[model samples]
Target: MTDKDLRRAVLDELDFDPSLDAGDIGVAVSEGVVTLTGHVGSYAEKVEAERAVRRVRGVRAIAQEIAVRYADAKKVADDQIAARALAIIDWSVHLPKDAIQVTVSGGWITLTGAVPWRYQSRSAEAVVRQLSGVLGVTNRIAIEPRVPPGAVKDKILEAFRRSALFEADAIKVTVSGDRVILEGAVTARAERDAAERAAWSVPGVRAVEDRIVAMARADKMRCTAARIRDRSSIPETNARGTDPSGGRKDTKCSDRGACPVA
Candidate 1:
């Protein structure tokens, strides 16, 4: 498809989603890359916007330049946001009690703690980003492995074998200490994501470096483009919260417990 057609498709996708206001959002396409610009009311909306663009066909990559802007009436103080974040996290059934700490500065929250599982660490961030006036979240939570590195590799490979999504032999797994590096190529982005998920599902994996690439076949590309066009006509339920920068490097927790507002 031409860049002009791709741009129109992206804009239509963004507008069709009920979860976000696409009034100020701009879409510019070159080749197959989509560049998003402008501002949104919340970080969640910004993320949803990007997701909408990705759903369109012919989108190879994205450059997210959308900014988060909170209205004055909805603006919340740092201390208030911190307190609310702490309360919500503590109340969550998925997270460990008192295992995560919250720190807020200028509407941004930083979570610091150590969890036995990657899901727990992600859960802590997911609950807090939905709070009012949260501009962004910096998840500094660390993962503590419970098994040997060798076993971790075996488990990850086993996971791939058990799943129908992966080719098993097509993907290569490299384990260094508790970190896993996945190197391979798949036909769709979902498969690459599945490989990463499989790697993280292992007991002793503390980190995952996904080097998998998605190379769509000619027929698959045509199907994907058709699917994008079809989906653009339908509306879906709204889900909240997102992070522009997918993940962060692990950092030592300097301020333990609930931190004071800065």
Candidate 2:
């Protein structure tokens, strides 16, 4: 696609996403690389903008330059933001409250602590980024695996076998220390992401490096995109799109957890 066409397509995709207010953001394209500029209400919105663009074809990579400038004139104290951040994390069942520590300075919240799964770490960030005074969030939380390496591999493989979403034998799972590596090819993007999530669900997984590739089939890509678009539509009253008990990521509906796809 021409640079002009690619730029327009990206801008339109950003406009179509319901989880963010794209008004202040600017889109620029050079070749296949997409760059985002301007200001967003929060760091969460900035992330949403990039994700929206990635769905479009011909996007080689993303350079996110958007700034998080809280538009509220009423200046909020760092102490207040810290207290609110703690409250938000405490209330979420998906996060272990004692496992997360929060600190705020200049409206930038920094999270430090250890969690078992990457999704929980992402969930903590997801919850705090929507708060009013947050200019940005720095996730310093680390994953400390709790399960034995042998058990972790078994757990992930069992999860894959139980689910009919994709073929289990086609994928390979490797564990070293607390890190899990998925190396194989899948037929769809959702299936690839599902494998990552399955690996994270195991108790002792500190990191999940998704080296998984998908077959370069046009029909598969189209179906995968359609699935993401359909699932991302305005979630129900429960802000987190899926149940915490569900195998999917335990995500909050307000931020990256839930988004409306067009």
Candidate 1, residues 42-148, lDDT tens digits: the string is 97788778877766656667899999999999999999999999999989999889999899999999999888888888788888888889999899998888988
Candidates in order have lDDT scores of 0.77, 0.75
Off by over 4 Å in 2: 1-6, 30-32, 57-60, 72-74, 160-171, 184-192, 213-262
Candidate 2 clashing pairs, residues 3+ apart or interchain: 146-204, 147-204, 239-253
**Candidate 2 local lDDT, residue 109:** 96
Best by TM-score: 1
C-alpha RMSD of each candidate structure in angstroms: 16.4, 15.0
> 1-262 in candidate 2: lDDT tens per residue?
6789989888888889998899999988986678899998877788788778867766656798999887568457999999999999999999986999999999899999998777899899999988887788999998876777778888899999997867786577888878888865555545666788888878768778876655435533443444444476543233666543343432221222111210
Q: Please give the range of 10 consecutive residues that has the lowest summed lDDT in model 2.
A: 253-262
